[model samples]
Target: MTNKHSETSFFITAEEAADQLGVSRATLYAYVSRGLLRAHPTDSDSRRNCYARDDVVDLAGKRRRGRKPVDIAKSTLDWGMPVLESAITLIRDGQLYYRTNNAVALSERASLEDVACLLWDLPQADELEITPSVLPDGWHLLKAHYAKVPIIEALLPLFAIASEDGQTGIWQCDEARLASGAATLLGALFACITGCCPDRHPLHVQLATAWGQGPVGADLVRQALVLCADHELNASSFTARCVASTEASLRMAIIGGLAALSGGRHGGMTERIETAWQAIDPDNMTAHIRRQLAAGVEFPGFGHPLYPQGDARAKALLGSILPDFRFADEIVETMRALTGKAPSIDFALVAMRRYLGLPEGAAFCVFALGRSVGWIAHALEQRRQGQLIRPRAVYVGPDPGSSA
Candidate 1:
């Protein structure tokens, strides 16, 4: 039997589930009996059952792996297993935590600086002495030349100059110096993004000032920054760790993280959501959605695999801002009805930008600024570990012996 549910659904019928697992009906039932998979009775027919597709896929993947070390290592790369340990963040039960504190709740009251201190294991933000580094010579010329470039791209050269001037040689600093450098880098980044000479004012307030926002807008920006601060072992964080594993400078690790985050599938997803919003007709949202669905286009900002229920960050941020933007509210409702998925944080960031009337790339700037904290945390942790992060590759190409 075919899966009658929408393709985006998390459940599948018994036949489809068994096919996915390459198992017989009897084995499928055995799996459910042993608690390897969960089954629910169908609404239309009580006799029929639907299985959790995620569980089935997980089991199938595990069964496909050989007992070789290379096979096991290869499997860990794609959400398969834990490849490394971390003490900074944990994602469990659809909730995100930073060092055992709930990240969502932290967002409610903490500034980005507070979260940075928490992640960096500092007693307080003041301990870091976070003063903005002076702008590199000719910064005005560089800024004017890159006025139209994407914010993420513009950050690379800016970071390179700041790193060269401010940082010592690779991995030579004590923890105190490293932490101080991290704070300085964060301040310099905020200065570059907001076009403001940073001061003792909170980074979020500086952002609000740069964007001409009042008190309420500043609070919203603060909340968004806290929520986006760190996620455990995400692509960019992992890349940061890999760079740090080589005993590179903290600036070098952050540069690697920025490069990874700029990919379309990572923090760059906000740009995709913005592009989709611009391409679709606002007056005919439903028809545009249906047409895009027919063309096999995946919705950019809905659903995160880690949060099977819904993205809590999105729920928290969007809950406050959705009522203000009717078009965004309608799009959220329509996409959920059509796809059985809720908005992810990327969507929430873009929606917040529109509500605040910020510039075109503000969403990404917020993400980069906030997530810089997490990247620094990872780099510091990896440096302490003092192990190179190289993993062996399982070669599947031509055999050198055969000269194929």
Candidate 2:
């Protein structure tokens, strides 16, 4: 997202520029046909237009005098196009891209109109309010829910007793504990499951005792737990702050956060991941790797940008509870052999889901549930802080002194 290389002047489209001017697309096209608008197209498609800052300002200045705009033949202008497209992008990289959410690279010009159409799409979030909370809040501090537990609470758990199972061993993904002991948050979660499961495997009973689950059910619960965990700074967070800033109820913020988590991205990744997993076959992992790579697709299970050494979360989950799952090893080894990388949380989660007999479509639910514990904790924290977060962006537009 760095724009250090971008010059002040750049390329933009008639459609995008038109929107900025509060003009209709048809009107902009008319201007383009006239000599008044300078259109820079990278290829045959005029939709791939780029505008020079100087040229746009110049045109804007010309329009200010109330002179009728002129039209020039499409053939009249022909100097540089790809160069123009390379400039004038909101989000710039080595080269300018349209920043469309479509799977295809925005490198090649996508439709300007379609890109603009998404302007209205908004995410929903849950609302939460807390009179006060002892935990930290927000997307960044999701893991803080566990690793950052209070000392008094930790001691209370050890001395406290549960109704049926004796102890509700709440394992934590604390970095220190992970390094010398259970190894990861994911591992900790799995151990908790095994600790709690009624039909825990003899070998896994120890793990269940530490974690806890049931053979007949808990898939939905687990998935909900993960999904509810953390959804990137979303609707709920927004609504919560909106309420808090106005000094509203804590309960409202929790509801806001809930609504946001249900949005297309957060609740949906599990489904997306499931679709990806189904498209890939763990049985023919080698073939699957080659096929996906040949097709120029990223293999589903490996490599996370955040975790360079492999996702510690994934490693902790796979390494601890399902320690003997060979498919996990196969995936890591084959991916390394094919692409020179390790597996990530998604991959590890998929493998876990696959082994647990959770349908591909349902894998994300597990993630959702895992995330919920953290989400509730964070919401509580945000409610506790009693501060509304509102980030601002730099205004890079026409100045009052400028002619246009």
Candidate 3:
């Protein structure tokens, strides 16, 4: 509660309102500048400003909740529990569970041709309804590393940049620049989110059961890559807007945005990258799981809905070079059996890491790196919004504790 400047009939001085609102003068001004409230210049000198009393009161009644940071690299289930066996059975009976003949006879053929054939098996695009993803002719990484474009351009048929020039007009980043930038950011995010790509992906937790914890490091790296990029609208975006509202420098706003993304909930899932592997330690599945639970942590990376059959990402990546991936036919079958739902990217990557003998921490690193792309895009968009990140809300509150 700071001091007040003065009170007027329809409004209050910036200083007085600041005091009455129980916030710093700077805080009050921030809301005003963000267009959350109306401001009026007081006198000829322009030394003072006044704001509508009602607006001030209304704003005070609305407080925004802090955003949780997003860890895109962290794995989430597509649906409910897919695998529910202990590590012991995963290792022992895994041979029976993982073996699959469905794609077996076909996978042995030439990879490129075989994969092309597999493409035909792909479920109908309209079924997904969200959007049909496509691989832009160039780059090849097993884990669904098709071409990624910025939302602004991706949404447009011509891949044109969104601008304010007019219906048929506008000026923004050109196609070349946007495409190049979008691809680079997305690639980085993928690497960060999952420890590897299709050719380079690791076996995720659900898939990692057959393999030990030794070689999954590369998969963790991919996790970092995936966590690095995503939609531009996230918690960090809000923070970036807060800074940009002040007309602050781009660098400063981005810094603020990054800070917001670092919080848990948003970025928390990234930890699952590492958690998934810990469950697959070769020493003992039951013991490891028990220890993990006692420590208040659960296994990471399993289950998904989009690919109720299995993580298309995993199936595709493994299908690309299953024989070369070095996992036993039985173990693969075991994973398939356990996963009642889709085998998400995380589960596939974790399994690969276990098969390859990579070190620990690779998963988390991958996740962090992957989401960095989305963060950068958001930071850039925040500045472009040309408005502060302020949302209005209903002001329903009970009378002060006992003061009512």
Q: What is the lDDT of every predicted structure here? A: 0.82, 0.39, 0.38
lDDT of 3 by residue, 238-282 (tens): 465566566654334434544554443443343454455544555
How close to the true structure is residue 275 of candidate 1, measured as C-alpha lDDT?
A: 92
lDDT tens readout by residue for model 1, 1-404:
23455355788888999899876665565455334577777767866789877888898887676548787777567665446767788776678888879999999999998888889874334555457677778876777787899986887776676555644563246654556667878877776687666788888998999999999899999999999999888899999999999988777888898899888898899999999998879889989998899899977999987787899999999989998889999999989888889999999999999999998889988998899999988988888778899977888888888953
Candidate 1 residue runs with Cα over 4 Å from true position: 1-67, 123-129, 170-172
Rank order by TM-score, top first?
Answer: 1, 2, 3
Best-fitting candidate, scored by lDDT: 1
Number of backbone collisions per candidate: 0, 73, 98
The RMSD (Cα, Å) of candidate 3 is 21.5
TM-score-best of 1 and 2 = 1
lDDT of 2 by residue, 1-404 (tens): 11222234466656567766555654454455333566565555544666555677776665554332222212212221111111111221111122223212320232211222222111211211111111212312333342344221221121111111211122122322211121122223332222221221221223223334464224323322322233223344444445545443333333344345444344444445556656757568789868878999765556643335564445544553355667667667777898888765556666665665653333443443344233333433444455665534345678879885
The best candidate in terms of TM-score = 1
